[model samples]
Target: MEKTAFYTVKQIPPEETYPVRHPVLRTGLPLATCEFDGDDAPTTFHIGVYIEGKLAGVVTILENAHSRFDEERQFQLRGMAVLEEFQKQGLGQVLVREAEKEVERRGGYFMWMNARKVAVRFYEKLGYIIDGDEFIIETVGPHYVMCKKWK
Candidate 1:
């Protein structure tokens, strides 16, 4: 058991973040899109938790989402997960809050993310709105585009 500290994904050594990437993609589902050139900047925004200096969890922020109705700048939340050993300890909330703070710091007014259908209630509890009908994203599963305004 260890205490958690916040970190900018970019601040962590790339190698540490890499291990959590695939695991988050697998667990987050439908909301986790395929790695389209995983190294691309627009495809990711990152935050994490470290316990005793070990990377314990990660969350990502994405911008410019694709919409059937309109194309506009929208911040997307992705890759949100805590290591198995870290679950249910409130670290997930910490990661999300920090990510939101970073988005605001970056001049981002709107935050968007595809929440897994199962996790829709979770985002809703956090003030996210579900948009469009359910859709299946390739390499991922089924999810809806969810967004929230940063106040």
Candidate 2:
């Protein structure tokens, strides 16, 4: 049961880049805080998943293109998570395919997120789709605005 590798911040290490403050990755956000903004092109990126070494799993990607749709430019996969005894062992689909291969290697095509309606069937089985409807993220509760496309 050893298969989970993906690091960026200098190949990770410094206590596994411990800055985890994820409350369901801040669910939908409103009252929660801790959103870094800077890196012009880097909307957001932070994935950590160490098995034998610990750290379990963590995520934080927010590549906003106007937060949600504004005509071309999007990638807001907020704070995914997996630490409840490393649930199911899949490691949240390897931290979302390494954050969709770093959002398609930075070219950015499309990859949104805001699913919290009970995880929305685990992001539609890792293919994400649902869009619009079901809102109320003010206090970070119900949500839905999933999207996917890496081509």
Candidate 3:
């Protein structure tokens, strides 16, 4: 899909991300389940991609370390989602790149996430590497720990 000038990406409050999260990531689950840990922490931040002034995608970043990473400064990327109509149009990539920039600005050396199995390739395309075996999170189905270290 061709890029559009109407698309914009920026930092937004964590709450602003919940709408997309609930529908895309937590379908059939309680909206509260879409709220992630450290979402309100001072060191955490959310990014939203807007198309024509309407938010079409969102991602949250937390200052948390993955057990397999030794970096003292790490950010966990979570609750990333784009509206179904916006999927495959490059909005997810825009959201991720925005989150990575924020993590780097915050002095983080690495960024990790429990990426859903189906979305693994999406993360890989953005330079994230799988770190361990895939596992299920009770209600969340299969996921793999993926990480990207700034070089």
Candidate 4:
């Protein structure tokens, strides 16, 4: 891991996530495609990982429940993105870990996401588990529900 002053993770406004999300998560789609529901909700928060002062990754967490999870206070992890040039340098893992801490701090008992099939192993490395069968998301390809909890 590149553990140096070059990296910083902090809370940011939803708009700040677009720059990273558009390319990393929605490359061929319009930038507006990156916008998601509940993005500006009172309980939603966005986190950005910067490399030498440039945004290198982003993630969003919002209050939502998954029927499979019995936990009353649940948060959904969404729009996680790491620029292609920065992949494998551990930024994606850092983004998710920070989001996990923030959610637990806010009283969330668990969190989940529709993880892309290609990234399933990545989330598993961070202690997230596949919760269901894989399904296709129209323009996004295959995905599997994954969940994790720290409370």
Q: What's the distance in Å from true for residue 44, model 3?
A: 0.3
Q: Note the clash tally of each candidate.
A: 4, 1, 0, 0
Give all TM-scores, in the order shown.
0.74, 0.29, 0.95, 0.94
TM-score of 2: 0.29
Q: What Cα-based lDDT does every candidate model obtain?
A: 0.66, 0.64, 0.88, 0.89
Model 3 has a clash total of 0
Candidate 3 vs. true structure, TM-score: 0.95
Candidate 4 Cα misplacement greater than 4 A, ranges: 1-4
Which of the predicted structures, 3 or 4, would earn the higher lDDT when compared with the native?
4
Please write out the lDDT profile of model 1 over residues 1-151, one tens digit for every residue.
2232543233343345556766656655432333433435744556668766667787767666556424355677767777777777766777777777777777776777777787788778788888788988776689998878755
Q: Could you give the C-alpha RMSD of every candidate to the true structure, in order shown?
A: 4.8, 14.4, 2.6, 2.3
The alpha-carbon deviation from the true structure for residue 115 of candidate 4, after best TM-score superposition, in angstroms, is 0.2
Q: Where is model 4 poorest over a 10-residue stretch in terms of lDDT?
A: 1-10
Candidate 1, after superposition: displacement of residue 7 in Å?
9.5
Please write out the lDDT profile of model 2 over residues 1-151, one tens digit for every residue: 2252532221232223334434444534443353444322334567677766667676666667644566376777766666666678777787787777877887877888777898899889988888789887765678988888767
- Candidate number with the higher lDDT (1 or 3): 3
Q: Write the per-residue lDDT of candidate 3 for residues 1-151, one digit (tens) a residue.
A: 2246969888888889888998899999998998787999999988888898898999999998777889999899999999998998988998888888778778776899999999999999999999999899988899999999886
